[model samples]
Target: MKNIKASMLAISLAFLFIACSGKVQTNKIPNETKYYLPKGVKTSDKVALDSKELQSYSLALEKFFKRNVKADEEKKQDIYQTGIERGYFQ
Candidate 1:
């Protein structure tokens, strides 16, 4: 009985660990998943990117984008260059 209980406890712990492990789902963004935009960016209307104001807006967007992207996934130089080209990072 003691052996069975120990085995069960170990299995339970293993299951819990696996359940709580870091698994970033890179599949697809659900339609319900809304992105949090800055106060200046209007959610409804299309607004032109003001070069002066773009810095703040870009920073906020970069933060949000970075949150989902894993560090390991950002291993290549292309990713860094693309971000720079797209004006995500300065």
Candidate 2:
């Protein structure tokens, strides 16, 4: 009976060790840092702009496009005129 009890305890301890040791540990805190470089961009040439700087840059580009949209349309019209003069199509 003592031998049986010792064998049972050994089996239970083995099972507990296996259960605890085989558990998959997850990351408690996620890393915000990027692991890989973006496609088509070199690591040395890249600049890390802050969110506010990016927002301002985006707004500036939007405003510039809005301001020069008419000029771009005029340039397109000139290109069409030149194409017609060159007899690109009948």
Candidate 3:
């Protein structure tokens, strides 16, 4: 009885760990050709932008795409603050 209970417990933990480690992939748009990069003052994609241009583009992408214009989490990129990076929003 003791051995059976221990084996079941181990199996449960293994299953739990596997479920938690799995990453959930949501439907995401990788590329958008409909909207091209809007013209704006060229700034460091490294530094975040607080200017009107950045705000305009960011809001437009978010409002239409329903995705926050942020950097690639896995790539360690910043908004640069272009808000639009890696064609993530492109």
Candidate 4:
């Protein structure tokens, strides 16, 4: 009976260790276009726009892209830091 209880305790502890382990899973595909504008913005795409609208759209798109890139970089950095903290790296 004591041997059976020890075996069960060891199994439970093994499962607890596995459950508590932190593993980071990421799905980041390089060279994949993740953002799109509803209306076409490229010159060769043949989307027409007036001077004022075009200027406004350009500014907005610039800000949007900058914000997204900054956020992505920050998230990547955070993941890297987490990996380091979890002893995945030296």
- For residues 1-90, write the lDDT of model 2, one tens digit per residue: 999999999999999999989877686665678565578885576768799999999999999777876777776757678889899967
Candidate 2 deviation (Cα RMSD) = 19.5
Task: List, in order, the clash count of every candidate structure.
Answer: 0, 0, 5, 0
Give me the runs in candidate 1 sitting further than 4 Å from their true place.
Answer: 27-90
Q: Model 1, 9-90: lDDT tens per residue?
A: 9999999999899689888766776866788975657768788688988999998887745665665567779899899997
Off by over 4 Å in 2: 25-31, 34-90
TM-scores, in order shown? 0.29, 0.29, 0.31, 0.29
lDDT of 3 by residue, 1-90 (tens): 999999999999999999999998798766776765669856565866679989899899887887444644555656754567445565
Question: Least lDDT summed over 10 consecutive residues: which range in candidate 1?
Answer: 68-77
Q: Per-model C-alpha lDDT, please?
A: 0.82, 0.83, 0.77, 0.82
Q: What's model 1's lDDT at 66?
A: 78
**Residue clash pairs of candidate 1:** none
Candidate 3 regions with alpha-carbon error over 4 angstroms? 29-90
**Candidate 2 residue pairs in clash (backbone atoms < 3 Å):** none
